[model samples]
Target: MVKKYTVAIVASAMLLLTGCSQKSDVDASAQKGAESADSKLNQLGAGDGMMKLSDEEMKAQLIKDLEGKVESVYFAFDKYNITDESNSKISANSKLLGEGKAGELKIRIEGNCDEWGTDEYNYALGLKRAKASQDAMIASGTSADRISIVSYGESNPVCTEHNKECWAKNRRADFKLLP
Candidate 1:
């Protein structure tokens, strides 16, 4: 009976001590959390300390960085072959792609056409133009896997005016960076 009484008292005392320690631990954790939150608030109030960039700011920075870097290669009427001038432009872009300075971004080749043919025909022509550019880029040492081609035929014309100049402008392959 004495042994049983002693064991019960000891268990009670241990539980009591454990309860007190757990409460203090919780209090300490709460205090630390408050301190950390206050520090973050202070940083935000000071207009500094690693704040997230606004969307506009991020967009502006991206545009500024990529400005004039992307090159467009134009195609002749009903032609899928890359012209000499377009090949030169592709060479320049290939160097940029090979250098790895643009990070792990995928390059999108957008193929477009003049509004003279049926939608199906134009789409095929656009794909051909894009493939020509892709082939040239790959030949110039760009990784084939890093490029993707999309054809937007007879649609999304850069110049809405129905003229030769506008048509010429529309028959082009454009390069875009994708994250």
Candidate 2:
């Protein structure tokens, strides 16, 4: 009876201690979980720290980024063929896109015409100019998803003067990157 009593007393004490320790441990674990949730909430992107990108800023940066990275593509007086220099620029853009320099890139092709051709004809030519660049990009390996085409068709002029220098600037394709 003495031995049985001792064993029962020891077991009862151990059980009591275990139950007490478990409660404290559970409380500590709950505190840790709360801290972790707060940290996560403070994180940016996944939390209130997320930033909103302005469209104007995005457009300006993309245009500037593309400045020398892709050379200006020139169109003929009335024809649209992959000009040697323009083709080279398109090839570079395609290579960059293929190599992952760009992610989900969106390019806008803006075409313009000189004052010579009729608005209707020049508009078609301007579209052809944009399409020419599009073809080059596609051929070089840029997915259509990364590109868009628009034709300003003499409506939007880089230079207002009526001269070859101004005409050259006006008769061109402009590439703008969209976010």
| Best candidate (score: lDDT) | 1
> Can you write out model 2's per-residue Cα lDDT over 1-179, one digit (the tens) per residue?
99999999999999999999999998998886463556755664654434655767665675567655765588768878877888888888777655543455677888788888666888889998999999888888888877889887889887889888988888888776665
Look at candidate 1 and give me any clashing residue pairs: none
Q: Which ten-residue region of model 1 has the weakest summed lDDT?
A: 97-106
Pairs that clash in candidate 2: none
TM-score of each: 0.67, 0.61
User: Could you tell me which 10 consecutive residues in candidate 2 have the lowest summed lDDT?
Assistant: 96-105
Candidate 1 segments exceeding 4 Å error: 1-47, 50-64
**Candidate 1 deviation (Cα RMSD):** 15.9
lDDT of 1 by residue, 1-179 (tens): 99999999999999999999999999888886463546655655555636778766665566446636868988889998998999999999888755644535678899999989966989999999999999999999888898999999978689989899999999999888765
